[model samples]
Target: MSMNPITFTPIGVIHSPHKSKEGTPIQPSRLQRSSGEVEIFSEFRPGLRDLEGFSKIFLIFHLHAMQESQLEVTPYLDDQTRGVFATRAPSRPNPIGLSLVDLFSIDNGILKVGGLDILDGTPLLDIKPFIPDIDHAEGIKVGWLEDKTHHFRNHQADDRF
Candidate 1:
């Protein structure tokens, strides 16, 4: 590894109706009506040119509200403790969150999206077009998340992390 600290600056900020962390959905797919907007900084506006063609986009953002991180955590759906890497717990070594949201429209530097599960003002790190050909798989193992995933739709986050 390079003995240098890597750094990232926010290219934009996310705006959502979910103001706090306490009640936000754990995953984007769980909240179909949760819509939000991503405001890209003016300097990065040109980067949004061809992105409008894609129906979905991956929002790579920082969990700015996270107070701290733990190596192991008891995740939202399960009662058992798990390594941070094995779960999508917000309290991670790196407080980064990735969500695949539906891109409804893009106007100026603002992108309107649905299926958003982020907090009010999360800092966006990057955005990538979601190409179905490369992003999806027909059959795959879900590890320990198999049985727990069925409960995600009705569950909302709390301060447990």
Candidate 2:
């Protein structure tokens, strides 16, 4: 087997109220009222055309603040340690984060979004329009998260990761 290193250039920066890992909302669904900005670089501004038609967008970003990677971690909603992939833990081999946020408006190269759970200064990797017809599904299983979803609404991030 062989592996190759992969690199990606950030398309923009995510500006959010969360300056620190502690107390930040763990997921976008948990922070619906929060607002933030995604400032796309000038080179990528042309890609923003027709994006306004969507009510929501998916933001894929790098977890820039992650200090280390862990194979297992105690997630915010659970007391038991779980595999990194089973939980939405920041400290992972790739450290990528994704969130679906409300697209409030787009002015110039800046996109005003709501329900932002990402941290400030996080590097934006990509943005995709959220299409409910394609993105949403019915009768899905959440695995370990199924029992924990009920308590997630009030959960905020701590500095564990």
Model 2 residue 61 CA deviation in Å: 0.3
- Put down candidate 1 lDDT per residue, 27-64, tens digits, no spaces: 88634588989999999999999999999999999999
Provide the overall lDDT of each model, using Cα atoms, as 2-decimal numbers.
0.90, 0.90
Model 2 Cα RMSD, 1 decimal: 1.3
Error of 2 at 76 (Å): 1.1
Q: Give the TM-score of candidate 2.
A: 0.95
Weakest 10 consecutive residues, lDDT, candidate 2? 25-34
Residue 125 in model 1: shift from native, Å? 0.5
Candidate 2 regions with alpha-carbon error over 4 angstroms: 30-32
Candidate 2 lDDT at 105 equals 94
The numbered model that scores best in TM-score is 2
Candidate 2 lDDT tens digits, 4-68: 98899999999999898998888886344779899999999999999999988999999999989
Per-model TM against the reference: 0.94, 0.95
